[model samples]
Target: MSTLTPGEQAVMSRFDLGWPESDIAADLSISFARTRAIISTFDSNPAHDRHREAQIRRGSQRLLARLRKAGGHR
Candidate 1:
């Protein structure tokens, strides 16, 4: 799988947290158009669809990894 940029990762993080597109844009300091484009690109990517299905079965391990990276305890 291709690596996501930090901005893309931030967008996905907020999206998974149930934040709206506008809110994500505002919170991340990204333009709404760019945020929407990232979301649209992710939605259209077949790999992301497969990843989502896998995550649904396995739970959100990736979020845990992010937390760990940010110094959260395991």
Candidate 2:
């Protein structure tokens, strides 16, 4: 919870992107059971919520930047 391991970050990113757990496992080269366990742990963490919120904020900022660049907004 203090810091996310690289695998955890990958799992979380794939999860957020709505990838199937099976695919996440295969892509991460982990067993499906272990993949589910890792994702479950990620889902249970408060840090996971924080991570999602941070990602949403970053996405919004990116959208605003694009809008400004296109003169869609001032």
Output the worst ten-in-a-row residue range by lDDT, candidate 2: 36-45
Report the C-alpha lDDT of model 1 over 1-74, residue by residue, as the tens digit: 68899989999888878899999999989899999879866755788778768866566677777788899855
The ten-residue window of minimal lDDT in model 1 covers: 55-64
Candidate lDDT scores, in order, read 0.83, 0.87
Q: Give the TM-score of candidate 1.
A: 0.56
Give per-model CA RMSD. 13.4, 11.0
- Residue pair clashes in candidate 1: none
Tell me how far the alpha carbon of residue 39 in candidate 1 is from the true structure, in angstroms, after superposition: 0.6
TM-score to true structure, per model:
0.56, 0.55
Candidate 2 lDDT over 1-74, as tens digits, reads: 56778988899899889999999999999999988877866686788778778988999999999999999985
Tell how far residue 20 is off in model 2, in angstroms.
0.5
Q: What root-mean-square deviation over C-alphas does model 2 reach? A: 11.0
Global Cα lDDT for candidate 2: 0.87
